[model samples]
Target: MDLIGALPRLAARRPPVLLVTMPGATRERLAVEAELTGRDWPSAPGPAAAAGLVVAGRAGGAQWLGDLWNGMPRPRAYVAVAHAGDAPHALDLLGRLLSSGREGDAPRAVSAGAPRGAPGQGGGDGPDHHPGAPGSGARETPGDEDGRSGRGGQEGRNGRGQARGQGRGQGQGRKQGRALGLGQGRGQEQGQEQEQGERGQEQERGQEQERGQERGQGQERGQGQGHGGHRGGVAGLPMAGRADDRDGLRLDRLHLPLGPALADWPAGLVLDVALQGDVLQSAEAHPWEAAPAGRYPFWGEPWLRAAGGEAVTRGAAERRRCASHLDSVGRFLAVSGWPRPAARARRLRDRLLQGAAAGELAPEVLRLTRGVARSRTLRWLTRGLGELPAGRARELGVTGPALAADGDVHARLRVWLGEIERSVHGMDDPRALTGVDGPRGRLDGPRPPSRLLLAALLPLLPGAEFACARLILASFDPDPDEFVGAGHG
Candidate 1:
C-alpha cells in the first residue's frame, strides 16, 4: 500500500469494532468479549472513529444497513457472524481487514456518497431524512419573495419595503415640483398624483396576486398532505405543538425514534419518543419485527426447547440463565457509563456460554455481582428510576425481575444478582428440564416476555431525564430474540 493508503491501516492498530446486533443473533456477547476492541456509534463521538462494524446476526434488509455502512469514513470494513461460534472467526477476519487496509473493500454505498450525520443512514429515505435535519422546509414558497415562509419573515420584509417606499415617495414628489416650476404646477401635481395612484394600485394588485398564489399552494398542500405538507418542519418533521414545559415555558415537543440499531439497545426494537428538551414527555414501544424465523430466542432457548418437548438438561438451562443475567448486567453497566465492569460482565457471560464449569466460574460471578451490587454510586444513580408499581406491572403483563424488583432499576439489579447466584448452584443439575422459567420470564405463551417489559418500559420513560430513561431501559435489557423464538441467549 502507498503511504496515504498505509496510513489508515497503521492507524487501525487495535481499532475499535462497532457491534451491530440483528434479531435472533445472540452472538454479540461473544463478539464484545472476543478481545477485539469495540466502540459504539452515536455515543462514540462520530462515525469516522471506528475501524469496522461486526454484525452478529442475519442481514435481512440492505438500504438502512447500507446507509450505516456508508456513513463511516473511508477504510472501513464489515463482517457478519451467523452464530456465537462464528464471532471469533469474524473478529479474526475483521482484524485482517483492518490491518491490511480497508480502502478497496469499502462498501459501494460509501463510494456513491451516502448521507452523513444521520441515524443508521436515516433508512432508505432521501438525504436530510433523519431527525433534526433541514428537510422539505427548504422548498420555495410562492408568497416568499425572499425565499422564506411563515408570517415573520414576510412581515419583516414588508416593513422594510414600506420604509423604503415612503422615503422614495417623498423624494419623487419634491423632484416633480422642481421639474414643473414650483408654484405654477398644481395641475401638473394633480396629474402626477393620479399616475402615482394608478401605479400603486397596479403594484398592490401584483402583490395580492402573489399572496393569493401562496395561499392557494399552502391550502393545496394542507389538503394533500398535512400542515407542512409531506415534508414538514424545518427539519422535515411534522411541526411539533407547544406544551407547558418544566420551566413553565411553552416548548415544541419532538418525536424521536431510538433503536433498531443503537448500541447496547435491544435488536429490532424502536421506541418512538416525545421529548421536551432532554426530558422524555411520552414514548411508545414497537418492534421492527416479531419473532425471527428459523432461530431460537437465544436468552430463553433451553426452557423454550424443553417446552417444545425437546430434552434439555437442567445444567444447560442453568448455564443459559447465568449467561443471560450476565448479558443483562453488562448492558446495564454499559448504559450506566461503567464500561470496565460491563466488559467484565460480558467476559463472564462468554465463559459461561463456552461451557465453563460452575466451580471455575463462580468466583468471577461473585466478584462482578458483589462489586456491582455494593457500588453505592451505581445504586444511587439508578435508584428510583423507572419505578413500576406492583399493581401496574401485573396490569401491563410484566413479570420476572422487573416485577420482582418492585419495578425499580436498583431492585431489578438485585433480582438479577440473586438469579445468577441460584443459577450457578443449579449448573450441575443432570435432570431433564420441562418448565418455562426463562431469564426474562415465563415463555409459556405465544408472546415473548420482553414484549411485556417493553410495553411497561415505554410508559415509565415519559417524565424521566434522557440519561435516567436510558438507565431505566438498560435495567430491563429486554432481548428481541426472546419474543421472536429464534436464538437462545
Candidate 2:
C-alpha cells in the first residue's frame, strides 16, 4: 500500500483515473495509495502521459478489474491510479511516474466527463478523453451521459465488444469452472439416488422376511389340523370287550407235549410255569408285554438281585454243617491277651479301688470285678458300663467286662475315663464336671448304633482323613508329603 514515489507522478501526469479490483474493507481499498504517500515528491509524470484509469468495482464475476492488468506491457510499472479517497495518491505521483504511465486520450463515450462531476462533459480530462469516443460503433443517444445510460449498467447491457475481449482472455478458465460446478451437482444427485436404492432394497428384504414367517406359521397350523383329523378318526373306532380285561398276562404255550421227553425253550423267552409239587411240568412262554411281575430271575442267575428273586435249589440245601456261635466267639477271644486284657484289667481294678476309697464308687464292686473294654467311636456308648447311671449313682463302678478290648464301645469311653482321671488327680477342675453332667450321674447312658456310624464309620479314620486332605495339597507343591500327612497307620 505504500506509494511515496507514485503519488507525485499521479498528480503531475494527471492520469485521468485509476482502476483497482481486490476484496478488502472499503476504507483500505479507497485510501490505500493515499495512506502510503507521506508527502509528494517534486517531479512526476505530467498530464501528457497519465490520464484517468478505470477499474471494476463489483465482484462474483470472472471479468474483474484484475483482468485488465493480467496482460501488461510491463510488470514493475503496473500500478494504476488509486480511486475514491485514494485518488489523491495518483494525482501526487504526476512527476516521478512519468516514464511508466501509458499516455492516451480516454475513450470518447465512457471517459466523457471523468475530470469533473458531469460524467462525459468535463474539460479537465483534456484532449485524450475525446480521442477514443467513437470507438463504440453503435449510435449515441443525446440525453445520455457519455452517450450511455447507467455507467456500469450500460456496459453490462451493451457490452458486445468489451465482454468479447474480457471473455476471450479468460475463456478456458471460465469454462473449466462451469464444468467443475456441473460435475459436483451430478455427483450429489447420484449419491442421493444410491441411498434411496439401498433403502428400497432393505424394505423389500424386510417384507420378504415377514412373508416367510407367516408361511411357516401357516404350515404349523395346517399340520396341527391334520393331526387332529387323524385323531378324530381313531376316536370313532370301537374298544375291546370286558372278558379280555381280566386276563392281564396271557402266556403262549412254548411246546406241545406228545408224551415224550421235554424240549427246552429258548433262553430269552419269559414263561409262566405250572408245576406239580416241585416237579417240572408245563411252561407257557409269554411276551415281555404280557409277562407277570417278579419272575425275571428265571432269565438267568447273573441278575438275581435285579430280578427281585433269590436263587433256590430243590435238593442238597437242607444238609448239616459244623457250626456254633461259641466257637466263633472263642476264636475272637483267643487273640485277646497279653497287654490287651491283663493291662486293661489292672487299670480298671485300680480305678475301682480308688473310687471305693474316695467314696465315689460302691465298696462291694472292688471284690468281684473283671475289666474288659469294648471299642466304640462314640464318647458315650463304649464308656456306658463304667459310667454311673442317670440317677442310680451308687451302682458298682467296675462290675462287668464292659469296656472290652478292641470293640467299638471301648474307644469312646477312653475319653471320659481320661476326664475322670484328670478330675481325680487335680489335672482338671472338679467344678467343671457339673457343666458336662459327667461321671457321677451322666455315665450309663444308651444311644443308638448310628452314633457310631456318624462319628466313626461315616467320617474317615483320622489317618485316612489326613491322607485324603493331602490330595488337595498335592496340586500346589511337588513335595506335598513333607507338609501334608502321609497315608500311614
TM per model?
A: 0.71, 0.15
Query: What are the lDDT scores of the predictions, listed in order?
Result: 0.60, 0.24
Local accuracy of candidate 1 as per-residue lDDT tens digits, 77-117: 66654445555555555656667774736321110123321
Candidate 2 wrongly placed segments (more than 4 Å): 1-18, 28-66, 72-77, 80-87, 99-162, 167-489
Instruction: Please list the residue runs of candidate 1 whose C-alpha ends up more than 4 Å from where it truly belongs after superposition.
Output: 1-3, 28-46, 102-241, 246-248, 290-292, 486-489
Worst 10 residues of 2 by lDDT: 316-325
TM-score of 2: 0.15
Error of 1 at 166 (Å): 51
